[model samples]
Target: MPPSLPSPSSVTRAAITLPILARAASTTSAGTAVTPNKPPPSKDHHVHTYSPEAFPLGYTVSSTHAGIKKKAGALDLGILVSTSDTPCSAAACMTRNVFKAAPVTVTSELLRNSNGRAKGFIINSGCANAVTGKKGLEDAWSMSNTTTSQLPPSGAQSDKEGTLVMSTGVIGQHLPISSILDKIPELIRTLDDSPKSWLDLSKAFMTTDTFPKLRAKTFKIGDRLIRMAGIDKGAGMIAPNMGPPQPPHATLLGVIATDAAIKPEDLQNALNYAVDRSFNNITVDGDMSTNDTILCLANGAAGSAEHGGRETEEKMKELTEKANPEEFGIFKEQLREFAEELAQLVVRDGEGATKFVTIRVKGAPTYEIANAVAKSVANSSLFKTAMYGEDANWGRILCAVGYTPLSPNPISPTSVSVSFLPPAASSNTTPLRLLTNGEPEPNIDEARASEILKEEDLEIEIDLGDGNEEAKVWTCDFSHEYVTINGSAEEEEGWMYD
Candidate 1:
């Protein structure tokens, strides 16, 4: 947002200048054709997604308010536990911010010490436990220890390496450790595998989200049925660049639990693969969070108790091709669909968001170029505002594409083309081209384009006419509600998060 806007009390969804598009492109402007990677598969190739009604095997959830949130009655604490007799294999991605929140540091350490195994997650809303120095670290460790200590022997022989912690809210504030600690027992007492409890657990850890986000999938390796479920929360600070306990990540908190037996190495591989096409591919405000973390736990409850899941997810050395054991391929595809669904939910629930925008950049020489161009457009405030207003302003979208930094091989408008495709979920396959092969569509249909913009979901198709590689990004349109939400945020005396 610019520093010089007049009183906006009366205005809603006003167009605000964004910094990214303000600067001139280092290369030829988007007016020229440029390169991007490949594009999304045709609609027929869309992943077969599902809405599982049952909970993932062996996991139960409990949630309660512990006065952590400033709002009274706001459920602020949650526990997601795996009751399998043994510690479940785990894989996690955390924020790479230099000033990582206390919980992120502690959870990452526990996963390391336990060698990618854990009981479950203990999360709190309100204080982020970031930048509080040593005290924050101690509180975070205690959060994990205290929550796991009360549970039966499971993931870790000791409680210290059992539970993971996730915290979201305001930064630089200390959590009321005593109060949060006191309520841990109550949370455990209320834990159950009921559907409502799982939903409650999702909302309890949310900050600015207007609704809870969760998804489920059930598939079998051979004849053994395996179930997976995922839950996540984020409305702002949601540009996730997470890696496997590596540098760079998102403050967007998420968990995908499955009862498919898999090795620790394979579980990590699955998470790394799905995240690239899922959480890491979506954005809200483009601000990476200090507390961002995504954890995947496989407790193997679907298999016999004596030996865990009957179908062990074999570790695949290469994910881009078919696995030697065929079954791993099926598991990877299902995992990708599940992760993508959870990530899309965040964009759909973006703070003050009005439109869900899908950007596909195709024909670039490399994945890096395609991803960069897609993000350039996805993060543009100007393009988002245009979508919010339902404006058929193709110029804003083109301008955003033009400004991407592609030195040494700058974009040339002659071969570049742009179009608004029919809704991805719709049966329509035809695209309404605004520009084709570097020339504006001679017979463009303005009314049809306008109709496309009116739809809640829209897809922008850009082709560089360069190569076969491609990339996709999912984002939402910023609106008047966005400015009001960020502009009006004020920390009260007692409330910390949100």
Candidate 2:
């Protein structure tokens, strides 16, 4: 396991209060649920208002109200620029949906053409340039070109300083290209390396997100301190299929900036490892969007140039091959933790979702089977509804697992078992064992199981007893509000900002 973060007492008081304040401000009217329309508090505690800054050096963020969103003054366009003297090395993972958006196409081309180097990112919310065909492509290209033209001379680096674009909101709509272009100058002028700027950038990219999602951590390689800060916007349509360094997608847009001096290829490898274990392991409504994207930029502002020369490629290759385990492990762990935290936040704030559910499938014949089984359970409407109702309905889970089409390896009913574990705060309570060897436990306490299911976070463990392989997935309970929110998404788009 990665090292545990020090308790807030060991860190700073803000470390404990910031997340609480952010979470509190994001709650629905009932104070327990999350809704897409709730705007973040005006005085966000997540900003560097108290102690300990939230971002790495050499990175600045800015946002502007481009009049794309229905609400006046709601920030709809944003940019994050890496101001390192040298070009920033970038790694990205985009959605695998075949029907990708225009911005996704442009981002893929830029990553390919520029060879994984970028100066900054340009993002817009409230008008997803998806399914708009030729015109959409031109508009996306225009966004990048206009943003690039506004950069200072030092910030521009020929083809090396590629600009990535991300758009999220109403699909099949053309972007307000003129408004976005007009705001470019102001956006660039407001860029600052402050925590408030990062927080604003996070909020600027939200479509239906109830709160700004941001996380930051500081780690050390040798004696030099390196910081990794990330912000993401996603609340629904969030089953991200983001694969290794690729393109872009919709709904989810994450940007992680680090000051660690690492090669682009190595950064890509680290991002892939982290994404597979984090974003790829989560599901919210199980509807993958056309514009899911996660981008990581390393500007090496910390000056740990131990891996900055031509020999760096060979060293990175060795690290990838596990020939140099220590340094590679440190980088991989830090990146994974960063990605995992953001991914979990996405699920925790799943639109109208009341409970966070973790589905763990164990004893499968192979990891692939375990993963499939976990996803089947995680995405099951019956299981999710049961969870939301706090019902100890283990049969729904078994049905989901059994119908997963595992091909030739038929599951043996007699070898199945299931258990429900409550949240960590209730450690004094024992896990409720619902099944044993495919038979309902004779001493099962249905009331206890139902009570445990009422917790905000739940863990359902399934044992196939087929083999030793295991996989885990994160999901959320499906409530009536989930259906209501999605059902009205189109009709209520204009009023969501109210």
| Winner by TM-score | 2
Which residues of candidate 2, in runs, are more than 4 Å off? Answer: 1-52, 155-158, 245-250, 303-324, 489-498
Native-vs-model 1 lDDT? 0.75
Off by over 4 Å in 1: 1-53, 155-160, 247-250, 304-324, 424-429, 491-498
Query: Once model 1 is optimally superposed onto the true structure by TM-score, how far is the C-alpha of residue 119 displaced, in angstroms?
Result: 0.9
Q: State the lDDT of candidate 2 residue by residue for 324-354, as single tens digits.
A: 4676679889899889888888887787778
Error of 1 at 166 (Å): 0.2
TM-score of 1: 0.83
**What is the per-residue lDDT of model 1 for residues 318-387, given as tens digits with 9 covering 90 to 100?**
2222343576778778888899888998888787777789999999988888888899889988778767
Q: After superposition, how far is residue 300 of candidate 1 from its true place, in Å?
A: 1.1
Clashing pairs in 2: 249-291, 249-292, 250-290, 250-291, 250-292
TM-score of each: 0.83, 0.84
Worst lDDT 10-window in candidate 1: 10-19
